[model samples]
Structures are given as C-alpha cells and as structure tokens.
Target: MVAVYGGRGPQTSNIQIRSIPSVVRRGENVELLCEVENEPDAAISWQRVDGDLPYGAESYGSILRIPSIQGGGIYMCSATTRQGIFDERFGLVIQEEFKRIVKLFIVNNISHSTSEVGKSK
Candidate 1:
C-alpha cells in the first residue's frame, strides 16, 4: 500500500477535525468529525493520544465519537489515500477549579435563596 498519493493524475487529499470547543467538561459527549477529500477510496484511522493501535475505516473521511468525557487527553486521526498518509492531533484539558465553582453555585442556588445568600450587611 502507498503511504502517499500515487495515482495516474495529480493526486490531492485533505483531512480535518471538526468539533465544538476544545475544552469540555467531563461526562459530556464529544463528536470528532474528520473530513477528507480524495480520489475514489481512502482509509481513515482515529485514536486517542494514549491509544494503543490505529483502527481502519473505508471512505474519504470519517468521524470518531466519544460517548462521554472521562479524562483529559489528546486525540489523533491519520488518513491514507492513493496520494499519501497524513496525521493530525488535538488536545483536551479539564478545568477542574472552574468546574468546582460551577458545582458550588448550583448547590448554593438549590439550598438557599439568592437574596439570603446576598443579604445586605
């Protein structure tokens, strides 16, 4: 198999990752979309930063879906066509303090009235 594009005519292919904000909260589902354009058939593989091996799929491009966010890490996708193989990686991080603040706000709202929480001295 060819690593890069190798065809009769000029070969060209592009791969990109599309999704919402890079920073996401834990327990949220994230969909990683890979868009690719090439000749007839192309192979795509997606793996997390700590992934073991690559999984293969047939098509110009594809999407990798994450059911829920467990931890912070990076994700990668590699595409191989008649032309060539290209790889890209994306990173994710958890904002623990910010999330904690949000949780606190939610708890306070449920337990106490806003006026009580913000009473005048």
Candidate 2:
C-alpha cells in the first residue's frame, strides 16, 4: 500500500508594526519593528512604497533600520508563510526643526563705565 501526504506549516494571523512613530525629526535614526501572530512561522521583510529605501537602510528578519532619515514616506512590512502573506503600512512624517538665531547688541557707556546688552531673535 502507498500513502500520499501534504506538508504545510501554520500560517500567520496578522502583521503588526510595533513602536512606529507618526512623526520623526530629520537627521534622526529610525527603527521599525514588524510583528506577526505566529512569529516563528512567518518571514518578514520591509520596503518603501514610494521608492527604494533610503541610503544606508538595513533590513533584518523582523526589523528595518534607516540611518539618519532625511526624507519621509510610506513604508510597508510584509509577512509571508507557507499558507499566505500579510502586510501592514506605516506613514512617517519628517519634521524639519526651525532654528532661531539670536542677535545681540552691546552698548558701552564709557562715562558711566557700564555696558548694556540687548538680545533679539
């Protein structure tokens, strides 16, 4: 007698992105963590939807790290298993911090031997 068997592993339920910030400041490093229901059974990968990931971007099994993010865009993480595939997206906004410069004016009074300093931004 001969018997036939099918080999299949457990599938992942859902894909989740953990510790993702809605807004990130420029020149700051970003680390995206992808989580799956059955983590051991799923394979995870990361990429940018608009284009290729920024320069110096690294992707491991479940984490994607971008060094000093200069631009912001939509990023997607997908989980694949023998049964199916699941995906999740995150919108990251890059905030440019405005710098304020201070101008100071100094007035020296020789007669009074005093000095006055005024500051302005």
lDDT tens digits, residue span 1-121, model 2:
1122336543336677875577889999999998876457688889899999999999988999999999999899988765566778888899999999999999996775666679655
C-alpha displacement of 48 in model 1, angstroms? 1.5
Q: What residue runs in model 1 are displaced by over 4 Å at the alpha carbon? A: 1-10, 51-61, 97-121
Off by over 4 Å in 2: 1-12, 112-121
| Candidate 2 residue pairs that clash | none
Model 2 residue 120 CA deviation in Å? 50
Q: Write the per-residue lDDT of candidate 1 for residues 1-121, one digit (tens) a residue.
A: 2234345654556677777778877677677777676533657788777854223322234777665566767778787765667777878665553434444444444565455666689
TM-score of each: 0.59, 0.74
State model 2's lDDT.
0.81
Q: Give the TM-score of candidate 2.
A: 0.74
lDDT of 2 at 68: 95
